[model samples]
Target: MDTALIVGYLASICSVTSFIPQVWKIFKTGDTAAISAKMYALTVTGFALWTAFGVMRVEWPIILTNAICFCLSGLILIKKITRRAR
Candidate 1:
């Protein structure tokens, strides 16, 4: 296998897994007090755009990574928004 491919896969894994701890923390403690909804909203939007761009370009890595990020960030953003409403 190519080193570049290995690096790409590693990066993708890192990017995708980075959200796990935050999600787990939120799930276990239900605390989003310090999380910024606006930041996450932008993050979700950026990931959504990146996913779309990846789809248009037929890039699996970008699509998969950003799609996962989009969903994870969207989850956080939703929690933040809903928490603010309460």
Candidate 2:
């Protein structure tokens, strides 16, 4: 395996896992007042664009990272929105 590819996977794993705590906190406390809707929207948009870039470039690392990132981020966004609504 390529060293860079290995590094990419490791980094992606770290970043993707980073969102778990936030998700848990949001779920446990049900307080999303501090979560910025604009930020989440812009971030998800950026992540989607980057995923597209990865597809065009045939870069698995970028694609994988963004996929996981997007999903986790999306979850957070939804949790925040729903939590606040309730």
Candidate 3:
């Protein structure tokens, strides 16, 4: 792959991996109290939009990154809702 493609892949990986901190915190501490439902809600919304945009633009890197990000963020959102209910 070219340098530009490599950079795109790295960028995608970093963006998707950005969810690791939140995921680790939730799993290790089992504490979702500090997390805001609204924020995650909005984040998931934005990720969905970005994913759609990536698809429309035929940008595989962006699509892949957003797909992983959406899943990770969705997991946290679900955890937040479940923990809050308990």
Candidate 4:
């Protein structure tokens, strides 16, 4: 692959995993007080749009990266909502 594609992949990897630490912390500590529901909701919406855009353009890196991000953000959103419900 070319340098551009390699860079894209590297960037995607970083973007996708950036949420893992937050997820892990939330999971381990069960603390959603610091996590803003509105922020994550907006983030998930943005990621969904990006994933759709990548799908329309047939871009694997964007699609995969945004899809993973969407899921991660969705997980956080769900946790926040459910905790709020309780």
Using all chains and alpha carbons, the TM-scores for the candidates as numbered come to: 0.92, 0.87, 0.89, 0.96
| Model 1 local distance difference test score | 0.89
lDDT of 3 at 35: 89
After superposition on all C-alphas, the RMSD of every candidate to the true structure, in Å, is: 1.1, 1.4, 1.3, 0.7
Among the numbered candidates, top TM-score falls to 4
How do all the candidates rank in terms of TM-score, highest first? 4, 1, 3, 2
Residue 27 of model 1, lDDT score: 77
lDDT of 4 at 8: 79
- Superposed by TM-score, candidate 4 places the C-alpha of residue 28 at a distance from the truth, in angstroms, of 1.3
lDDT score of residue 13 within candidate 4: 96
Worst 10 residues of 1 by lDDT: 1-10
lDDT of each: 0.89, 0.85, 0.90, 0.93
Q: Whose lDDT is greatest here?
A: 4
In candidate 4, which residue pairs clash? none
lDDT of 4 by residue, 1-86 (tens): 98887887899999978889999888888889998999999999999999999999998889999999999999999999999999
Per-residue lDDT over 1-86 for candidate 3, one digit per residue giving the tens place of the 0 to 100 score: 78887888999989978889989889889899888999999999999999999999998888999988998899899999998888
Shift of residue 55 alpha carbon in model 4, Å: 0.4
The order by descending lDDT is 4, 3, 1, 2
lDDT, model 4, position 57:
95
